[model samples]
Target: EADIYQTPRYLVIGTGKKITLECSQTMGHDKMYWYQQDPGMELHLIHYSYGVNSTEKGDLSSESTVSRIRTEHFPLTLESARPSHTSQYLCASTGETQYFGPGTRLLVL
Candidate 1:
């Protein structure tokens, strides 16, 4: 099983603040994904990468961007956060099976 971890489990920030949600996995998984979800809403894939240095935006349009500099690291960055960006950000890495991090809940004031 991949040990995925997300930092700042909960965040509360004022609008227009730039934030980066950190996601890391202990296991070396080539496929990684980032998803966004509002309370009680279904998860929407925002970004994904096939491997290090390969990234692609997901179906849902988002203001944030993601980069995979290393096989075990895929971080999502929001240049300027807004209230509408408030939601839970989930990170997952897939081997034979997909494993997810605890997720980061963000609130922009």
Candidate 2:
């Protein structure tokens, strides 16, 4: 089973606010990823990490940042929250296959 976790499964934030979505995995997988899902169910890669101190933005456009200081932790930060940033964020870890955490759904108004 996957040992990954995400806090505040649902969030309602005002526009211009700052929000941090927490993501952590106890599996020690070196590869961690974050994907953004639209309301219509289209998913897009937004950020990823390939081990400690290694992080890169994914294919999609995102205003968030990610950091990997410890192997079991990868957190995403949005400096300013907006209604455009309202979406479901999914965190995942990969070995031979990917294991996902329960997604965090954010609604910025």
Candidate 3:
């Protein structure tokens, strides 16, 4: 199994609510990333960090925020969740290439 894990693999929230999706890895990889993808859709990079405290927001994650205070944990938050935010969030980390998390599917009504 992949060392990466995501909480509340599925979520449903009212519009304008707030939520945080957690991602953690036991692989000890310092490089972490977040991607937004819909079911059966192409994954788009949203946020990434080269190492702890080195986060960068990608083009697709303009509305989201990420912080990297620890090497094994990278959490992404949406302050005001909307229907447009409904999608799958995937977390990845590097070893030889990259390892992916199970993915969190969110739905906003």
lDDT, candidate 2, 70-96, per-residue tens = 999999999999999989999999988
Model 1 lDDT, full chain set: 0.94
lDDT for each residue of candidate 1 in 15-61, tens digit (9 for 90 to 100): 98999999999888899999998989999999999998999999899
Give the Å shift of residue 20 in candidate 2.
0.5
Worst lDDT run of 10 residues, candidate 1, spans: 1-10
Q: TM-scores of the models, in the given order?
A: 0.97, 0.97, 0.95
Model 3 C-alpha lDDT per residue in residues 4-83, reported as the tens digit of each score: 99997999999999899999999989899999998888999999999988999887745989999999999999999999
Displacement of residue 7 (Cα, Å) in model 2 is: 0.7
- Candidate 2 has a TM-score of 0.97
Reference-based lDDT, each prediction: 0.94, 0.94, 0.92
Query: What's the true lDDT of residue 6 in model 3?
Result: 92
- Per-prediction backbone clash count: 0, 0, 0
What range of 10 consecutive residues in model 2 has the weakest lDDT sum? 37-46
